[model samples]
Target: MAKQFPHITDTHRDFIARQYVFFTASAAEGARVNLSPKPTNAFRVIGDNAVAYLDRTGSSNETAAHLLADGRLTIMFCAFEGAPLILRLYGQGRVLHRDTGEYKALLTDAFGEEPLGARQIVLLDVDLVQTSCGFGVPLFDYHGERHNLDRWAEAKGEEGLAAYRLEKNARSMDGLPTGLFSEEPAEADPA
Candidate 1:
């Protein structure tokens, strides 16, 4: 059975903090839905009705594109080791680019430090919170965080990363502009 709440409770926040990974889902009206698994350490609960996560550089910027087109977003967390619960946050999300003052403030206030390969911040104004019994979710043992992304980012450097973002992360697979590289025109074929 599932239960719904208007805001995230302390218990809910605790559950979220213990999770190792979460999933984000978004979509534009005419575009394919995007679902991505993200590390838990990158997420933070700002308030009972708000949450934010550091968006790392990826092959595609589908989440940013989808949010720009439509603000709808869903974030889900499941207990993979101890409790049997699945929690979800439903809200409108917006992307805060690294160039923005708000991003800098949030980087300092919320995240404590800017992470390597951090491209943008995704902030969600949550309207609904839900929890369900995740009886079927299997428990997995925790190992360690992967350092590959950090290594890749360090190797690319700032100029290379900016160029790569312009070349690759500026558009979604469905041809929607992500606004990552605002100086460049949106490419029809983001190949």
Candidate 2:
């Protein structure tokens, strides 16, 4: 049975905070569905109905593009330890780019512009929340986090990172507009 909305309580937020990794899924109205795992502490609760995450530079930019077309975004946080729980936040998402006003407002003083490049501010307006058994998840020992991605971004710096996005993320793998690292989205001219 699906747990209905407004039934999820505050204790669920506590479960979310305890998660070290989560998965994000998104898709446009007419594009390939995107599902990826995020293993960093990139998300946080900002309100009873809203949450946000720092979108770092990555190989793909499907989430940003998908938000532009359709705001539907699903974030799943599984308790990989201690207890068994799979919490899914079903909601709409808005993408705030580095040049966008919302990005400045959401990230101001919340983080430092160091060690990595800032891509976008993804804010989710929760419409529903569900929790289920996560007994099938494999149990892995907590060792340590590898800083390779951070170090790679640091070494490349922001300028290089922008170029990387331009080269790899300007378009979706399905040849759809990604709207990332592009001077102007080619879709502007629908000719």
Candidate 3:
């Protein structure tokens, strides 16, 4: 059976904090839905009705594009090592780029500092909270987070990352504009 709540209670927040991973789901009206597994450290519960996460650079910017087209977003956290439970936050999400002052302030307040490799901040204004018995969810032992992403970002440096984003992240697989880069397209690189 599933349970619903109007806001994220203290207990719910505590459960989210204990988890090591979560998943984000989003979609546009006529586009393919995206469900992405996210590390727990990247997420934060901002308030009873709000949450935010640091979105690092990835192969695609589907979430950003979908959010731009349709603000619908759902964040799910499951208990893989504890009691059998799954929590979902259904909300509207906005993608905040690092260039914005709000993004800078929020990043600092949430993480003590701006994390390297952070491409955008996904802020959610949660309206509905749901929990279900995740009896079928298998338990897995916790190991540790991979350092490969950080290492790759460090090697890319700032200028390299900017160019890469402009090239690869400006559009989604569905041809929806992600607005990740500038409105004007950059010059194409020679193959």
- Every model's TM-score: 0.94, 0.87, 0.94
Candidate 3 per-residue C-alpha lDDT over 1-191 given as tens digits, one digit per residue, 9 for 90 to 100: 99999999999999998999999999998899999999999999999999999999878899999999999999999999979999999999999998999998998889667666789999999999999999999999999998998999899888888878887788888988897877746779988
Candidate 2 has its poorest 10 consecutive residues by lDDT at 109-118
Pairs of residues at least 3 apart in sequence or in different chains that clash in candidate 3: none
Error of 2 at 120 (Å): 0.7
Give a tens-digit lDDT track for model 2, residues 101-150: 66787787454452376687788899888877888877766787778888
| Candidates 1 and 2, the one with greater lDDT | 1
Model 1: CA > 4 A from native? 183-191
Give each model's whole-structure lDDT.
0.93, 0.79, 0.92
Q: Which portions of model 3 miss their true places by more than 4 Å?
A: 184-191
Q: What local lDDT score does residue 95 receive in model 3, on the 0 to 100 scale?
A: 96
- Candidate 3 positional error at 3, Å: 0.5
- The clash numbers for all candidates, in the given order, read 0, 0, 0
Q: List the residue pairs that clash in candidate 2.
A: none
